[model samples]
Target: MVDQQTPVGANAPTRSGGAPALRERLTRRKPVEKLVAETQGAEGAGLRRHMGFWQLAMIGIGATLGTGIFVVLGEAVPVAGPAVVLAFVLAGVTALFSALAYAEMAGMIPASGSAYSYSYATMGEFMAWVCGWCLMLTYGVSVAAVGVGWGQYINELLHLTTGLSMPAAMLAGPLEGGLINVPAAIVVLLSMFALLVGVRESSRVNAVMVAIKIAILVMFVAIAVTAVQDGNFAPFMPMGMAGVSAAGATLFFSYIGFDSASTASEEAKNPQRDLPRAIMFSMILVTALYCLVAFTAVGALNWADFADGETSLAGILTAVTGTTVWAVIFAAGAVLALASVVLVVLYSQTRILYAMSRDGLIPKAFSTLDAKGTPRANTIITSVLIALLAALIPLGPLADATAIGTLFAFALVNVAVLVLRRSRPDLKRAFRMPGAPVTPVLGVLSCAYLMFSMALSVWVAFLAWLAVGLVIYFSYSMRRSALEHEDTVEVRS
Candidate 1:
């Protein structure tokens, strides 16, 4: 697809599908020795590269294992029936293809900015802004969404263990008839402050949550498998194909942090090499956990009960094990794990805003750094906004926006991989997407299909978000853009 709008001489790349042109490039006589212009060296971009396998693995786990495994199980199982296990696989498969694309692109760029950076290097500024806008909303709103879900789990854990219960309205949000969730708001603030301190500290914190979350999930799988009566799995695919699609669309929330792993290219020790490893490695683990968790939930209870239940995983576990321990573990895991999601995701979001601010897209304050070498101003502002939104807004609307926006970014990044591969053959890539052009093509299509499957209301909300992004871009970003000023240079390797 030749983007007619794409400008030339500026050298925007064309997307490939392993077609004639792609084959021609691959069959070239020499690889980078077929070099066109750039010089050879270990590094070019100013980014400090020191990320190792441990950090990479931690990031992968941090991003992939989260609210999805903890919450989406209820949303997915109720809709997909016992086949919710399959939906986990389905979403994973779709995500895998795109992650492969991300692996390739991350290897090529190896920048801390994530998808927004890749889009700028390959698709040019306009598309980059679009992607950047989508990413900002994707991670930004998710900070609040996860915070909201976290509040519920905290309430559940308190009531389950100590028999202390908060009013239903307070546990929920103001829009849902609750005043506010102080704990959830605190979690958001805590996560923001953690990031504001530094990535190393934040990663350490995420590691702890990862352990707790996995332990809780392991217990659920063990307990649920033991109680599998075979009767609960009977109504497989009860809602039919439409329901399956809806489940896929709804379950999109679980897959949120897959890309967050790749956003840390600057700090990555061998980023080009380890970045791709972390992305795919983490997805594989997340998919297995999600499938097991969902299968167990469906096996433990009647699917219809999930549709009407106030508490998702907690209710399913209570019904399945005929005890509240499972609920306690699940709730406890959610409470512990959500901090990981919020920390890593807000970290990624701030990095992206830092990039955009460095490029003059938004206010410079977003990229402002304190003595800790962290974005204190940006993190604080982001936390406050997320805290307010989590305190006041309803979950359903926030979830919808996050799902649709994230899927859109996924599809675009997939295509952007192809564009970069074809046009910049000289660029070095540490990790490669399997099937080359074919995989990315399928990735784009799959993601787009999922995006469209969302409700009409979601589309309206997306448009509204994009509209605001566009207004910011045109009125402030475009004019103040470092690119236009010629004072700014792209920080790509």
Candidate 2:
């Protein structure tokens, strides 16, 4: 390992020929010791350490459990039929492979940038920027996607209880025949308020909501199980293996939040120990819940009925009980569940930007924190932009874009693990992934396969997004990056 006090760009070769200098700048790696040191020094001072193991676990659970199970399942089931259950398993397994890679990386590096930080320490400055850019797509757009679902369930709850609904013009985006998704925008702003208050306060609210959502899901399973028809699952693979793969690609959006815990590395009480456990524990709990809910849901209501909207689980409860009472309760739970997703994913988005800002890759405003140890400016800016996205875009396109970005970032993290293992074997890791080289290799292959399974349009959109990121990198971030200077960069107040 490199010395903790080493200057960030101290090892770079001086003023080489044009192409060589550019190559060195792109491939320049930040030392792991410096990565850890920044968190203990002025750069990480504004973030408070308040989260313990369970609170960290709740971060992961709060983010992961909601959107997929509560919202996206409705979208996924119609694509995969009863085999949506298999889709859940496939997505979970792919996530598990990356989760293992995350565990090892989090234990070793422990930074707020998550995979971006890991890449900076192992791959280089340019790859780190690419990873951070993809994460922005993953966390930011996923918040919009979940917020869209929140609006749907809000309408479901209103219809069951008050016999009314939000105006059609306010219920969906223009693409979905509505002028704006008012409820989705509202939910994102509400979550933004919670985050601005402080992470500790936001996390306590998240913990309570996480518990409520899990209980509601368990209740759903118990009630729906009694109504299961063996015949509903008769033609299980209606769309066949291709459908299963496509649904699996779509459903990967649900697994996005499990890694949100890793982003809290700077705020964690015992990051090395707690982060790994939180990442793994949350993945296991979420996978089990997803499988159970998908199985019971298909068995009770038939996969075809899941196209109803974001209220699929509540719809199942109502169908089984033959009344709207339980459906109302389920819808209420879903509102709380999806709101938690917005809070956590939005929180992660700010932290990733904060890390980038501290490295001079972006403006210093994002790194500025208020007295409450919260990134007030970052929170406000991110929420407003996400609110507009949620209001203007429909859920399906938002989700596919998020899934591809997330898978691409995960692939890089796996590669980072392989790189670090070879280059810095002496670094101590609190949690070493069991399978080592083979596991991370599988992680890379699995993520690539899922990304390949996405629609052609999704690939085009993803490539376009990457192109924009490259343009920003070459035009702005490259010249401003901390690695281009010799002085130690400090976070702005």
Candidate 3:
């Protein structure tokens, strides 16, 4: 556990006497000791710490393993050919580099804001706000993306089990000629209800769903391997390295939830020790599962057949088994899998907003807790907004935005680790990332490379979102920040 009584700003740099007020405010750093002390003081008034190591690991796995293997392979395999397997490896490698950085920071800080809190302690308030803003995009949009994918699998399962499909008008958004994706919105609400009950309850539900999804994937590998064709390996690199890189960028969406455990730091019984272990363990396990499934998936069917994003792993199962039984089973698992993603990611989003709200960077309503120690208002408001997005937006755009936002946040995390190591070397860390400066530098470079591989349209969309965030920050957040008041008090005293 962190030493909660360390004085605020004990190791923080003294402000330069000649610095301008505006510059000082913009670059003001929140000491890690202060963060930990606040958390300790909140005790019963804040989120309850009920999660153990396995639950945290399950959060990571449940959040990560869903959308990629079940939904994204269709989008990625056509781009990378049979070498989509390599794309999974590439994306996993990128996530691994950042995961190491996240583990180190989680051990030292153990806060709910994840990278955003780390940024506050190291990069100052302005950057922390930016990182938290990006995280809002990452987790909020990702829930919608995963929810949309869940609706597709629900459609597949309905078709396989009952020989009937949902009305197309109700199954997709306007872009797909539907009025609204009702099932997608419905799943988001279901996950919200799970979270409203409490984090402990949500974690239990996620653990069960995570187990089911993993078993389903393992079943897929077993059934698909029997149907493997050496011929599928022949034209593996048909699209070449460019295709591979592009697919890696797309597939990076699959690894988005691997760091979700870090967001649960405040709710973990032993965050410093368990949080780091959960992060590293979950990433390694998720990467292995991704590589295995991707290899088997490409081997089982021709890569060109994956163009239909809605019918992904289930289609493969149906084709291989020559029956709807296994495909139906897989589709059912997929529904549960994607629901778990929505649940965990929604939890992460609420926590990030809670941290920001506590800092007065957003409305205090976001930080309000119910009798169960759940952020009830925050959960409902976030879920309603995200559900609207899921109901109205197309999955493709939602996913691309999520990928870009997640990569940007992750890059900041790597930078945070470097900044903190140099600024506060005396802080105890239960875990340390090896090859320090070199490793984090590579993490940043890899995230940038993947971001660049995305289409220009994605970049445009990301910038537009950031522009909106900047406007909010300047107009409201900066003036209302709790740090501003704290600074004033110190000067007066």
Candidate 4:
């Protein structure tokens, strides 16, 4: 067995007892600060940073408007009734606070791995590893879950419009007592290929899907508002404030995908200048759009009849139009929108893993970039794991688990903003969060409140995941940490 211990001052040549294991103490900055510098300087090895505030907004809409709205209606509407509209506003406000905090961090750190990199720079190694690990749960597997959802809606659309007779087992997810969901698996593979091709290419396709999605929602609202019945909202707070808060927890998931935009800081045209703008702008746009859709949706249908699963929006349109045409079109738009989200989110997860591997925190294999500068090895492995999980489990658990991992990251980032402000006040910030203490405090409290409202089972699952992370960190990460050296240190003073 190899001994991992280092003598005191192991990295300092000036130390008495041991020759400097000079590389160890210096480990602190390279994986943390150096990577930070690398992203700002040289990370655009493949794709050019050409996105603007508008493109960033579209990316936000593309990611957030998909899965939760399409799938969550069945879950949230029943719980809060017409008050689900208020729930959307409540969740939007909570997420907006966190997003503002994130924008501030992105301006300062401007790294490729979003919250993980920020944690490393401010909180040090242990928390960074945990954040990165939880991030995998948040993003890596979410793509698989959304892909399965897209498959269901697509199959239904085909049946409703094309009159194709598809078998239940072929179309149904594995969790639904089916052997395999061929369409879901197929979509995952297709998305993997697109991601492998390149981000620029993916973004082009993403842009088109985003436009369609926005159009579909606008069309839904325009028609729905015309059909509003005041009767539907007589008992607006049917389930009361508690129900709104509870549903707000899940609806918060719809607001989260904006963070992925910040992860592209490495590929941003001007990170310190534009990354913060992009992130905040995206958050604001999505929040307004969600509020609009929620208000219109509750007014278009009786709150009691919204538990129609994937058909909630469609059903409302059908009831109002006295035809299925608009509903089917809306569902089809949803499928395309969700598909883009799954692909982009999966790409974000793999890239984050690749970043960690490059720091030697994980196996070096994970960081290997193909000729195209895509992290093929990491992407494939993560996809396979996500596919298996999605095949066997339902979306509720997967979504809640993702929320837990994400909120944990959010709390760390909120705290990190404070750490960096105090520790590196001299660092130039292109963007700033006003009322520093209040912003971060509210951010943490809001995230924590939502996290608690989730099912107890989610809490247990999160604990189990944390246990696994600790085991890995103690067993291998501590020993291999680039910062393990006892001697060398970088100091500003």
lDDT of each: 0.73, 0.88, 0.88, 0.74
What is the Cα root-mean-square deviation between model 4 and the actual structure? 4.6
Provide the lDDT at 184 for model 4. 67
Comparing 2 with 4 on TM-score, the higher-scoring candidate is: 2
The residue ranges of model 4 lying beyond 4 angstroms of the native Cα positions read 1-33, 40-55, 163-165, 171-174, 308-310, 485-493
**Distance from true position, residue 338, model 4, in Å?**
0.8
Model 2, 217-265: lDDT tens digits are 9999899999999999979999999999999999999899899999999
TM-score comparison, 3 vs 4, better candidate:
3
RMSD of each: 6.9, 3.5, 3.8, 4.6
Residue lDDT tens for model 3, 226-325 = 9999998869898999999999999999999988898898888899889989999999998988888898888988887876654488988899989989
lDDT tens digits, residue span 175-216, model 1: 777777776688888887677667787788888888888888
In model 3, what is the error at residue 317, expressed in angstroms?
A: 0.8
lDDT by residue (tens digit), candidate 4, 75-150: 7888888888888887777777778778888887767778888877766567788899999888865776677677
Ranking of predictions according to lDDT: 2, 3, 4, 1
**Residue 456 in model 3: lDDT:** 95
State model 3's lDDT. Answer: 0.88
Pairs clashing in candidate 3?
A: none
